[model samples]
Target: MNAPIIIGAGVAGLAAALAAAPRPVRLLTAGTLDAGAASLWAQGGIAAAIGADDSIDLHIADTLAAGDGLCDAAAVSRIITGGPLVIDSLRAHGVRFDAGLGLEAAHARRRISHVKDATGHAVTTALAAAVRAAPHVTIIEHARAVALDVAENRVRGLWAETAGGLVHLPAAAVLIATGGVGALWRHTSTPPGADGTGLALAARAGAVLRDLEFVQFHPTGLDSGATPMPLISEAVRGEGAILTDETGHRFTDELAPRDEVARAIVRHLAEGHRVRLDATHLGAGFAARFPTIDAACRAAGIDPARQPIPVRPVAHYHMGGIAVDARGRASVDGLYAAGEAACTGLHGANRLASNSLLEAFVTGTDAGTALAGEPDAAATTAPAAPPRRI
Candidate 1:
């Protein structure tokens, strides 16, 4: 039998491949091996429960609260407790983290881990490098899985449309880590490739899906006219930024849950009031801290230090996808999912800010480990391509 296939190359996909180590797997990527993933665009730091004043239970409580009681309690506890270990795993893969754990809105303590404003870039680049160096992984780029070939409800293989052409690869198991559906929206922070491919693939394979409508719009996406709006990470507000209107008067609580804050912005905008994020008080420290955001603002011809950055709501995260269990196993056998593509009942109705990266890491690692423990690929049928068209 051929190796199991892992689709997507974000942090979750990379983490899954690394955890499946010593057991080879085939990985498919839709773009550049290192940069094209939406993970590279994530601005906020990851959340972990390792801060001096924090505890796993507190983290769980905050996640549950943000999720608005829709989260699975056990899942919340399990994943949140594993965050520190995820941090350790990233470091083990040569992902260097910058100074300071951050505090995101809705969290009672400073439990977010970071490599400054570009956490995603640092973590993704490092993990991709580690995977490239690993002997157990084979990466095929610019390839998108179009369909899963399932027989009798078990996934036998998948057909992908690549730069070369259509090809099929048989495997004993397949894991979907294809990220989110944010790009499906008119204004979003997800890459164009994040058009719900994993959810589609999983659903096509007869995998159960849930909560397909729980999209969380971020409150402070830079109100630029870019196609996919540049995100103003929650960390900015968690630090000291404030939300103000045209009159420069504070309106809603800046650190409220993402949905609430976004709703406030949307309502304010609907009423014809312009909203802005006042990071001006942060001064030059803003540039040194959020270089990516600062640069984007500057490119928009506005200095964050001198102006209250123009802001609005933009779809940032999906709190739904293929339904899966604790080990990231989907309802179907021989199939698994992690990251934004899989709804493991953690995020619930609204995702706690910065919890996405943490979920991606924990679930990916869990899924990979489970895959490694499964029956060896050699015990399965050989690769079989779909029938050719006339």
Candidate 2:
């Protein structure tokens, strides 16, 4: 059987490769690992239902409530119910989640998986390693997909530009695991290359894209001198950091939903106020617990241990993308999506804390099973490259 073609080697694509490996798969990525994808910069943990007090129903309800009015019930059910399985899968792949933090607020119990504060990095590292070990999986680094190769209302393959030359790779199936459109905004935590490529590709291929306007803005992005806002992981605040303004007056509560917190931070900025990350409350232990945030604060000339680190709201994740069903199948035949690129309605208008990685794991495996169930067929070659346009 011909290998399935996967685009964008971020968490979603890597997860898909690991699940479908040894079964014929070619993974294409635009840049070196950890440089362009938001997954690498993610510092929080993964949401799950493994906590003794938390129920799958509670997590689903939080996710649906946070998503606002656009969440899909069945999709929410699938992800919420699948959370424990996803965590187990990660552990099997060598991920070590934090212990003894029973379900956080908004949760009935503790169900988040973590490896210190670097859960996303650990999960991506493990998934990438697993894929690398799979001989059936082909890795094409520095290969940027220009567009989806579709013909007669069906997906055939993709057109990509590689370091060598323009190459047309055919495949029995295509998975668009490329991430969000965070680049559209001026200040974003998304990889610069993350500009709406996935959306453009899916839309060009005649797929239905939804909720493009539901972009999520994360509060507490370091306001120091980072060109693209560097995020101060929510887990820090969850661990008791405070949000304040320059005068040292508390502005927004740390526990507020992300959208509200982001909007509030933006409003403060427009009012000429400087937002601050009050890690003084967390003490020297702050740097010990969240090394990334500590390093970022120090690099920006702020000693978070002694004073507050300046912060602002920045575009983080997209709450919408190529619409898909419960099994991660796109509306188009022979095309599937997982992770950030595919919106299965688990994250409504806003995502609950640490749920992004969780959704990726659950849907990636589902997409793999669904893809493997397809009939064997010959792959169609990609067409000639077209002129690039924004």
- Top-TM-score candidate index: 1
Could you tell me how far off, in angstroms, the CA of residue 283 lies in candidate 1 after the best superposition?
A: 1.1
**What lDDT tens digits, residue by residue, belong to model 2 across residues 128-207?**
88888888788888888887667776777777888788766666778888888887788887778778788788887889
Error of model 1, residue 75, in angstroms: 0.8
Weakest lDDT window of 10 consecutive positions for candidate 2: 100-109
Cα lDDT of all candidates, in order?
0.87, 0.78
Q: How accurate is candidate 2 locally (lDDT)?
A: 0.78
TM per candidate: 0.96, 0.94
What TM value does model 1 have? 0.96
Tens-place lDDT per residue, model 1, 143-169, is 878878777777777888887888877
